[model samples]
Target: MRTVTVLGAGSWGTALAIHAARRGRPTLLWTRTPEHQAAMAQERRNARYLPDFPFPEGLRTTDDLHQALDGAELVICGIPSHGMRAMMERVAQDFATRDAPAPMYLIAAKGIEVDTLSNMHQVLAQELPPSHRGRIAALGGPSFAAEVAKGLPTTVVVGSEDAHVGMSIQALLSGDGVRAYVTDDILGVELGGAFKNVIAMAAGIGDGAGLGDNARAGIITRGLAEISRLAISLGALPATLSGLAGLGDLVLTCTGGLSRNRRVGIALGQGKKLEEILAEMGMVAEGVKNTKSAYRLAQQQGVEMPLVSTMYAILYEGMAVREAVQALMGRALKAEREW
Candidate 1:
């Protein structure tokens, strides 16, 4: 069996580790928190994140980075986007000094970095040595952690600059209840995963404000148009935007009650402060942070992402949610262009 290691013992990371272990791969899950590691080791469940779901028999948990990474043939990074760079730097240090072979990397985290505005793959490329860069891949789509851990039907796509790397990830992760597809459009996949969270937040805000299904649908549809435009400006294929990573993930996150980003938006629309909402949720809502990054990136690339811009204002500049909605509705009328 291929030995796999998953960094970050959060819900998504734990779920992916469980899936891999159930597929008969020898999998190890790493958590930086010693308390979390102890809890998982004793209870066989991540009580903090994935409390109800017990880990598979074949899976292991650890706090030591070296022990977790030892002999790992495949490394799936489940760390959140904000901390990914620092985590990768640590990983690179280990790779440099350790005798263990470098593993193929599959990044499952979604979102652009806050300050650098780099995608997860870009963060990996920047932190890891040049020799290790070519082995990186990204996995993204509409799959949720709870459903995936329950072994419900879930499908996702893996993308890489190297076609073989994408296919290798697909082969390693695809099984009875999990489906994996391969793509060479890494830029499209990464952009789709990161941008949809921003749109989901907008959709949630509409729902929270009782704007009705019409308003919510409008946000989702227009959100896709904005994402596609920005992604194309960044050299992503327009067709990839309409596929699972784009439209599929967007629809699920915008409508699904399980979405942390959508829940954050809901709280915001209900008149709760962003700080309070985040404190209450205790989970990383990528959209809240990604809003600023996406907005900055849109400006940098000269892409018109009005919804993203409005979200940035609402999130970072203290603009009222209703006022933001009004601004969106009051925009100058123009031809309905998808680009």
Candidate 2:
């Protein structure tokens, strides 16, 4: 079994650590705060994020990055998108001083950076040295943290440029209520995972506004097309978008009760301030920030993503949700198939 070190002690990170430890892989979960690490270490549970799930015997908590990275074969990054670059920079510094072989990176965070408009993989590539870059891979699909921690059946994809890397991760994470698939389209996997949150917010807006199932069905179907257009334009495989990481993840996030992005949207539709919603949730809703990044990225690529644009308007420009929905409905009709 590969010794695993999971960064970030959020719900997703904690769940993954539990999953790895349950597989009998010695796992170390790292949190930025020493107080949190101490609390979880003593309690054997992540009280802040995952109060219900108890840590397995093989799992440990740590505050020190050096301690977590030491002798680890696989490192799963669950940090939020905005914090990823800084975290990676710290990791790079640590790697530079070490003589040992670097561990494989499996990015679990699904969002584009607001500052640079770069995906998680690109952020890793920018921070890590050339030799260590090849070891990076991404994990995405419909798996939610709370469900995965409870040992529910979950399927996810591990995407890497190197087939061997993808296969290795797939083998390690498969079974035990988690089935892993491999894909060579790393960019597609990342984009699908990141952008789906945006669409989920849209679906939530429809639901909160009481627009009914018909409108939501339309939003989901058309949302996929918008995501596919942007992903394909950025050199992602069309097939990858239709696969688990794309369509599967999108559906789950849009409709599932556990979706934070959708919750944010619901609050927005219900006439709550974004600040108030975020303060109350006590978690990072990636879609809120991803809306800005994707909006700018699509415009740069000249991809028509009205959903993303509308989301940006609602979240940033103070546009009314109902008015935005009306505008979306009033747009010029075109052939269903762009080709």
Candidate 3:
């Protein structure tokens, strides 16, 4: 049996660990805090992140990163995007000091880095040795942690610079309840994952305002067009935008009630203060950070993305949601299609 390690005990990370163990692999899950590690070891459940899903019998929990990863065949790094750089630094140091290295690293985080404005895959490449970059891959698609843990059928994409590595991840992770597809164009997969959170915010705002399904559908459909345009400018194939990582994930996240980012947008539409909503949720919504990063990227690529720009303003500049909506509606019309 192969050994798999997942770093992070958040809902997503726990769900991944459970799934890996259920697939007949011995899984090691890491949490940064010693308190959390002690709790999971004795309690057999992740308290804050995934309370309902107990850590499986085949899963091991630990606070030590190296101990969790040592001799593992595949390491699933599941930390949030904001904390990624620091975690990667630890990973590199651990690998460098090891008598021998183990296997490829797979990233399960979703969001663009707020500081460097880099996607998760780029951060992986930047942090890992050059020879190991090819093994660094990303996973994104139609999934919510809660649903996945309950044995709901879920599909996602595993993207790497090397198709062979992507396929290996798919083979290891996909099971009866979880499905994974592979891609060599890592940029497209990462881009699709990052931007979907931003678009979900707009959809949530529509939901909160009680604007009816028409508005929500409009936001989802148009928001997809904007992402497609942006992805094309960044060297992604057009068809990738419609695949599981793009259109499929967009629909699930924008419409799914489990998304914290969508909840944050909903609160905003209801006229709640951002600080209040963030405090209440007490988790990283991701769209809250990705809006700024994606907006800047759109400008750099000369990609026209009014929705992303408007969301950024509402989130950062204290603009009202209604006014942001108005700005989008008032923009002048062109031929209405990008070739």
Candidate 4:
């Protein structure tokens, strides 16, 4: 049986670990908090995040990083973008002295790093040793943890610079109700995953403000155009934006009720303070932070992302949500540009 280790015991991580374990893979789930590890081990569920879902019997829980990583052939990182680099550094240190085949790394997190403006894969490369860099891959698409845990049909894409890496991940992860596709456009996959959250927020804000279905549709459509432009600016394939990791995920996050980023935008549109909304959420909405980073990246790359800029203003500059919408609607008329 293949040994798989998933770092970070969040909802997504736990769901993937459960899937792997039920597939008869020897899986170890690592949680940074000992209390969480104990809770999962004793109750066979992650009460904090995945309360109702029972863990598979084949799944193991641990707080020890070294123990979780030992002899693992595949390591999936579910840590949030903010903490991803630190976690990778620790993983690198754990394997520093051991002379063994490097495990294939599957990054399950989606968000651009706020401080460095680096995507998940870039952060992985910066932290992991040179030999391990080529082993990195990213898993992305419109996947909700609750649905995946319930064994609902879910499709995702795994992408890497190396064709072999993408293919290998697809073979390992695709099974049962979960379908995995391979792509060589890792840049497009990662950017699409990160950028969609911001667009979802825009959609939620429109819906919450009672902006009508037409407005929501417009936001979703234009928001995708902006995402494709930004991704292309970063050397990503344009067609990749039309694939599962881009258009599919964008539609899901923007329209789905389970989206945390959309919920944050809804609260903002309802006139709730950002701090209060975030405090009540009790979960990290990547859009809240990614808006700023994405805005910065757009400016740095000379990409025109009016929606992302407006979101950054609303999120960080205290601009009213309705006002932001108006600004977007009132932009100078121009011919349709899909670049």
Best by TM-score: 2
TM-score of each: 0.98, 0.98, 0.97, 0.98
Give the per-residue lDDT of model 4 (tens digit) for 1-339. Answer: 668999999989999998888777899999999998998999999999889889887899999998988888899999998999999999999889688788899999889999889999999999887889999999989899998888889999999988888898898788857899988899999999999999999999988888889988998999999999989999989988999999999999999999999898888878889899989988888888889888999999999998999999998888988688779878888888633
Q: State the local distance difference test value for candidate 1.
A: 0.90
Write the residue-wise lDDT of candidate 1 on 1-339 in tens digits: 658999999899999999999999999999998888998999999999999899889999999998887898899999999999999999999888877656899999988998888889999999997788999999879999999999999989898998888888899889959999888888889899999999999999898889999999999999999999999898889878898899989999999989999998888889999999989888889898889888999999988889999999998898998799889899888889633
Please tell me which predicted candidate would have the highest lDDT against the true structure. Answer: 2
Once model 1 is optimally superposed onto the true structure by TM-score, how far is the C-alpha of residue 265 displaced, in angstroms? Answer: 0.7
Worst 10 contiguous positions by lDDT, candidate 4: 330-339
What is the TM-score (0 to 1) of candidate 4?
0.98
Q: After superposition, how far is residue 139 of candidate 4 from its true place, in Å?
A: 0.6
Q: Write the per-residue lDDT of candidate 3 for residues 202-291, one digit (tens) a residue.
A: 999988888789999989899999998988888887777899989998998888889887888788889898899999987778788889
Model 2 C-alpha lDDT per residue in residues 10-106, reported as the tens digit of each score: 9999999999999989999999999999999999999999999999999999999998888889999999989999999999998888887878999
How much is the lDDT of residue 212 in candidate 1?
94
What's the distance in Å from true for residue 257, model 4? 1.0
The global C-alpha lDDT for each of the candidates, from Candidate 1 onward, is 0.90, 0.93, 0.86, 0.90
Superposition error at 40 for model 1 (Å): 0.4
User: For model 2, what is the C-alpha lDDT against the true structure?
Assistant: 0.93
- Answer with 1 or 3, whichever has the higher lDDT: 1
In model 3, the runs with Cα more than 4 Å from the true position are none
